[model samples]
Target: MKKPLMITSLALLAGTFLTSALPDRFIRDQFKKAEAQTELMLAQVAEATKTQPVGKPALVSPRTLTDAGELHMVPARDWTSGFFPGQLWYLYEFTGRKEWADLARQFTARLESEKMNAGTHDMGFKLYCSYGNGYRLTNDPAYKDILIQAARTLSKRYKPKAGIIRSWDHNTAKWLCPVIIDNMMNLELLFAATRFTGDSTFYKIAVSHAQTTLKNHFRPDNSSYHVVDYDTLTGRVIKKNTHQGFNDESAWSRGQAWGLYGYTLCYRETKNPQFLKQAEAIARFMLNHKNMPADLVPYYDYDAPGIPNETRDVSAASVMASALYELSTYVPKSNYRAKADAVMASLAKTYTSPVGQNRGFLLLHSTGAKTFERDVPLIYADYYYLEALLRARK
Candidate 1:
């Protein structure tokens, strides 16, 4: 449902022992399990490629859970196109295998052009997740250029009047300029751009967007609305609505996860106390909710009308886990670390695929959208799950 962030908070390790909730053995075992599971899926994707009626590699499918339960991948241009490649990079980071590196390179190659595509706000998701991680691990000069290009493209979408990056180009009739909570997650690319080139333009854009998002995207409870429509001509707020959540008024599980993770990252990048406060408020709303599942994996929407029966979104849980782990670093007074650990624990215990199931994915029961794919295993879920694991011990 969303994308990258973090290592861990030193504040967390310095404050208290997280071992009670996330033990060393559990972390090692999950990686071991992930390695075996990932290898299986890699082979499965390769084999599936062999049978394609078209004469291309297997990475061309949507990489989404289909009606037939196949691990079909989409084109390199798809919104989710970067995830599977990004996953391969994570595999390389975790396992230290050259084969993973080779495959990661090949998959990352597929998205090379997206760095210049400004059609959407997710260049951060597309290029940053794959090449950003690649540049971090490899420091390839070529990869560095790609990351800069993508950051520049993403910056093009920023509306100076609104002080926010535009989320979508096609929703003009409904929103003069729609700014979604997910855009906050993309600011990392801008921050990276500034760091690489010493260009304050990128940094300024990132801070401005975050500040505007803080002003308009949240509510009294700090549970975020998915989209905030702004009058582009005057930069005025017009309406707030949810496109992926159950209803405009409900707190979508994944949307909240985006806000928590996004603001936590904002605080990390800027050391701004306001961002930390925003992140903490979001954390409290979700944690103190009456309907939050005991395991910490929330329902598709907190107020989706059907409680106890609504599908659990492991994707949201994975995201919240990763975010909480980072948020814990900034706030020593809260039990965010324990909550993050428990979410990962539940995923490993309940949501993980059996040895030969889930099309070789790790976590399961992640809802992609309401009334569709209620219990599918999504690639982003697997990405964040691994991320949370890596964060657990860092």
Candidate 2:
């Protein structure tokens, strides 16, 4: 019995060693693959640039491929416009390569005009992801000015009565004051704006929006509603709708990811216990869901009718993994890092594109919505996957 116990202990120690070693190996391989794929993507971008009409801001940045297998690009006004540049920024951060920084700067410069486009609430998604990463890496004074201006434009959508930034102007017929859980993500811009300019109004607005979302957007179980319509005049709730979920009551996977990331950042920026508690609760709701797959990537909607047949959203997993890595630092005793590792490993092993496929995107099978961009390689998916890898490296 003593001899058997000694052998068992040795086996357990070996297993732990292998487990700890896997992530380092995985991270290195993924970065190598990412660099190769990014090179292919850059070639594609260069070809696309040649076709751009003169004197217009070229939409050369890759967003995703269309269903027909052709590359799709969009102008800076598109919500997804910033992610490709953000990926370039991540590559620069990972490699410390001057070439990557030069490419990132070129692509990032295309979106500078979006700083004044206040018609939508995606200022953070558009500016922060592009210029925000650039600013972080370079501290370019011009980048700081653009970010501050973008924050000011984003602030224009904040209604004091509703206590939330309005998410859309096009859907006004359906909602008087629509505030999606995604709006939580845009708050980071406001917080950073305050940090850059020492303006408390941005900080106050961000806290107000976060507090309002915490109070109204979450279900009893901490799962979030996709959209919460507010009475702009009365500061009252009108309805809770799920624009991208299986149903109004179902948990949209990416929405949950957004909530988790948003609250985690909110806590980091403000050190508010409520935000931390909310972040933990959201994390619990996601990780403990019965529908969460063994691979740690969730279905497009947790309550989608297909269950085992439902499409997995790699984008959501990527975002969740990135957020969890940061969240783990805040709550070191929690299982967030382990869970993040599981997700990253799964993504690297099964969900990543081949060395030169999927139009050079790093990730695959990300659903943009239940009805649109299903099972495609989204640029944001790749961006967040790179972000998670960086966080893991740290």
Clashing pairs in 2: none
Candidate 1 per-residue C-alpha lDDT over 1-394 given as tens digits, one digit per residue, 9 for 90 to 100: 2111122221133213334657777777778777777878877787776665567433552355677777766666666777777888888887798988898898899788778788889887778879988998899999989888888888888888888899988856787788889888899889999999999999999999999999988888788899999887789999999888899988999999999999999999999999998999999999889999877889999988878999889899998999999998888777899888877766776677766666678777888778776778888888888888878888
- Clash pairs detected, candidate 1: 61-73, 61-74, 62-73, 62-74, 63-72, 63-73
Residue-pair clashes, model 2: 0
lDDT of 1: 0.82
lDDT against the true structure, each candidate = 0.82, 0.88
Candidate 1 regions with alpha-carbon error over 4 angstroms: 1-21, 50-62
All-Cα superposition RMSD per candidate: 5.3, 6.6
Per-candidate clash tally: 6, 0
User: Would you estimate the TM-scores of all the predictions?
Assistant: 0.91, 0.94
RMSD of 2: 6.6
